[model samples]
Target chain A: MSDLKNLRGKAACVGAATTGCGEAPGRNSTELMAEAVIHALADANIPLHEVDGVFAATAVHSMAAMSLAEYLGVHPKYSSGSNIGGSSFLAHALDAAMALEAGLIDVAVIAYGSNQRTAGGFKSISEPMPFEAQYEPRNPITAYALATSRYMHDFGATRDQIAEVAVAARAWAGLNPEAFTRDPLTVEEVLAARMISDPLGKLDCCLVTDGAAAVVMTRAERAKDGPQKPVYLLGAAMAHDHRMISEMPDLTATSAADGGPRAFAMAGYGPNDMDTVQLYDAFTINTILFLEDLGFCAKGEGKDFVGGGRIAPGGALPVNTNGGGLSCVHPGMYGLFVMIEAIRQARGTCGDRQVDGAKLCLAHGNGGVLSSQVTTIWGTEETL
Target chain B: MSGYFDGPGPEAEFRQFLADGKFMIQRSKGSGIHVFHPRVMVPCSGETDLEWVEASGEGTVYAATCTRRRPEKGGDYNVSLIDLAEGPRMMARVVGIEPDQVMVGMKVRARIDDLNGAPAILFEPA
Candidate 1:
């Protein structure tokens, strides 16, 4: 939550795009980021010269905001590099909105790009080489697995329940032609898949591919001149709970618990008001925690909430409608794509997977093994 | 490494304790908070008055997972978080048992082992 409450300056996401998603071998991170920025500008029908604020994050790029600005040849008055983790994009989105609300900038570009699949598999050393590396907590996978193990021990959540998240994501992927893995998926198949880390099979983990996504944000009045109807930002919240998995205060809880309520209160909305949802799914364990902490279900009921086509197509709550990192395109950091998908759904631009006359959407991004959480709510003009 | 790492600055004494085959944690005199990772600051209260104390090294396995990267690669091992007796948790691998046998809440103790050609910490069922 920010000090700038009851923001009078209305902000809308006027444009968004994804580029070099999937296995794009030749496209480097720089090229992919540039492509996404250009595509996003075109989608907004705003010239590149109009962008006065820039925000960028990438696993492979340092000082990403400055690098992207140099590459795109666009100067900016406000710039920031929020490399919190996969959730950095959501953090950037919130930062952009806060800056816009404060009259710091008029137009902001939030961007991300990565070449994890094509350049190098997701086998690189930890960014700072997790301090506990010598003690051997196999990264993100095992670190997250520990939490899943504790969840089962505490709440009786089963492996099949966790696999259900993968099945739902894959089913949604089958609807989008741009999704990387669209083939049919099942619980048994997910359980049988190779185990990368205990309690998490290959299917339970997100895809490793080349991808980039970007969004253009401007005050609602400035967005009136854009190409498509603006998707207004109703509320946003970001929190950093911990950096290392061992330092997490509660094994099953994350910063999502802190950000979820604040964002909802900011918008005066609740879980039942959501027409659709898009949550970061770096690991199925993350979805379960978000499902519970985001108040989609009672605590410890996330395992049941996601099972038996609960989040799949035609379900009561359609989540990860554009496939998601699990089945769609998860380059390295995946938060930006959630914003892109949320914006698409808010604008009624999602082709076949669109929620029927959807008016409100919730997108949550988790970073650093559920350490950092950034939650944002979007709404069409009708809902506003 | 970047400048100004506020959490824990080069815990040289912690490493020295490790060299002597002893497990150590920081006990903040100001607040009596036991800090793992040899950090100087107390999490419960922002106090830097710390004293290094040898830990009991006995802990309960809060969580565990078997990490395997390939079918034919090196044998899988169990990574776990141990809730030490001092009320601090640590990241360490559980040894002397099959990777899948390390159960949560099981009793465990720390032992020094050579990892990546350097002395490091590991856990075994107590």
Candidate 2:
């Protein structure tokens, strides 16, 4: 779509920053967005007046991009608030890149902020699913538990293997001061946590914390004028199979299969070439499911691939080095933070959690019960 | 499309049928493919030639989970995705057994039951 190969390295993310995460008392989402946008623009050494495009998606505002621009007092020529789920930010990044490459906008700022933890967490605003509403399943968690059950039934993935994901994320979180939870997590502790749904415990779910993140993008030439080294957009792709989990053709698989291949093809790279990975880990099963679907391992091999401390800190393959949503700040929409962490790692700015010699990194975002999957490949100037 | 526009919507019709003690689903008249969560068009073929047909009321559990709730809050219940013998999957609860005992691959049969004071389709071991 839209000649992904031609768009390779045409636009780059010059600045990435996050506002104070975990707990921001008495602050609204718009304030968080404004602060993050200001910080990110300062990181890029660009004035707010130079931002001609705004992109954002949030649960608080229906017209999130417009609200962000108005709050920040900028007149934008281009904007999008398309909410496809948590992966909306990565999708917005692709949209911004297209607009920048087309000369429609010279500077684009994509951001998201949520105070879900300060407010009530996880509201029930789902439209009636007439055909399948009677079952009384817990909206998202039960759906994930259902998938975990099927994966276990089909591939013999054990609870311990799934627990390894949480353990590894906690290990990474211990290195990041911004993480919401940094205590050492063990497999037994995860299994012993209160059961929210069958095959999934409280520890299996992601954190509910107030946070905001933003990224600034510009044309390849303009990025060279920025203060920070540009994290080039090598490839980006997004796809979705079903809106509801029951409608999914296969619970163990996700649309990452389609998007991952296309993104890698556009970048002329493969999974093996990546130095680190950042998967949207809303649930423990998600990491395993994505690992398999994204070509990191064969079908049904994700459980074993993450075993024996493979994905943990200082492991063979560093994944979710910023602790991921499980331990990091997950303020409902987490895709922006996922993309930001990958950018930070690729820039070698992550002091304690950075992967050594990480020239190339991959960030994958998921939304709506594995509904939307967007895979974006990023690299430093050396790789380009 | 043919039958849905006659009276109430497809969803209302399905619920009324269930209330009348008949469990039904939609079938694409041309392709014979079944669909669940009643919709306007055949999702795969985009054909509007749809008609109401009684389901077999027999299905196999494709996946299942026991959602835990406190004892004062209705205790625990099982949520299951059942593969109907007619080829459509739907979400329901597996009854007549412990919530945690509803296993994947178990054969189940649908029956009319009460859900939040409304008629619902619940499943039991076949």
Candidate 3:
């Protein structure tokens, strides 16, 4: 019911943290989250006690707003503890911005933390619904495998073509000092990595790291008095199809196919206007599928679009500039990283990793086997 | 008389009082017709007049995936989305085929199997 045009806020993303990539740290989820929140507040030059709202997103652990507020030693006027999947963090930013515009809260802190890599922590605790119980557990890798199979069947795409996406990501990671796996990987290395699922190798899947990230958002007017630059929330959209992989109408096309255009239209920009992209990369297939679904390329042509150095650093569209969830730190909080990188690029604070002359960036998040999608367009200017 | 009814809780329960081998699908206690899973629900005009039908267990693979990485709780297995000839798609395990052998539109038949001592349906190449 909220109109995109009515949305107005001067929001500055302050502070961000990741545990890098690989094994889960010994630290608990709450500790990691609190650390990120404190760091973000310091980065924005704001006292931690001044934060008025808190929003948290997590899949592997639960931490309510009150508990987090207690941990951070800040009593927030407004709070949220919703879990909409990886993209939930970005959704939280939009929600915070709306709330700020409506005078609900002046400052909001959105954070995500998880320990998925720790032993005995990566499995679902609850049983599947009765309908879902009938089927085998289709993990993310398998969900992507089904879509990859269809992609190959329909487009005549080959393993080599898909491997190019990994190759490009690793190439970018080589340039990112904060990236988890910096070693340059070739198409063969990617193809030969331990096969997690048929047609999907170890390199094709994202790493599960233990980490947390936080962003302090406040009204543009408030942020203007704080940070030197404010990255405005130009547009945002969310969409869903079916929860279970089996019930999805089509595996290749995402709800983003609908959500992307709507967000872009709201922002008054197109794919070409984006200087950088932070797409959710749960797997190589998902990246390819989203490229098509987001209108970056034609349907069934994602493999071809990614084959060249297009997504590389100097290519047409520099994607996952922070190495993404694949090569960067994936805390099961993948969406947070996307937002972090987009803010960095839009603020032009990425230093050596900054996309030259960047102005517009797209941050995308995927939840539940690509079941839910949230697309956000951010800019250096205040559009509303 | 055997009948399916709502449980004391907010969930639906299937009460097998008769051995008619007939399964009636419905959206709610008071909807139009009875469909299957993923249909949201089948509307039935009245609960008493619900139509009962037999399942063929014959279907085709609408989509499938080979999973080498499954949650620790769920044993590793290949998963698939199957489309029945009667007009509904369901999730099941693909058996009797190599991971590379599974393809879309492949003919398959459902086989009810024991999953940790409970009844669960799986599929194999027909």
CAPRI grade of model 3? medium
Over A283-313, each residue of candidate 3 has an lDDT whose tens digit, in order, gives: 8888888888899999998999998789977
Per-structure clash totals for the candidates: 0, 0, 7
Query: Considering TM-score, which of the candidate structures 1 and 3 is the better prediction for this target?
Result: 1
Instruction: Give all TM-scores, in the order shown.
Output: 0.95, 0.97, 0.89
- Model 3, C-alpha of A237: deviation from truth (Å): 1.1
Q: Compare the candidates by TM-score and give the number of the best one.
A: 2
DockQ of each: 0.69, 0.84, 0.57
Candidate 3 i-RMS (Å)? 2.0
lDDT by residue for model 2 over A270-310, one digit each (tens)?
A: 99999999999999999999989999999999999998999
Using lDDT as the yardstick, the better of models 1 and 3 is: 1
| Native interface contact recovery, model 1 | 0.84
Instruction: Give stretches of model 1 more than 4 Å off.
Output: A1-4, A123-126, A129-131, B1-10, B69-73
- Tens-place lDDT per residue, model 1, B30-82, is 67778887764667577767788888888999988988855576678788888
Better of 1 and 2 by DockQ: 2
| Window of ten residues with lowest summed lDDT in model 2 chain A | A122-131
TM-score of chain B of 1: 0.85
The Cα error of candidate 3 at residue B92, in Å, is 0.8
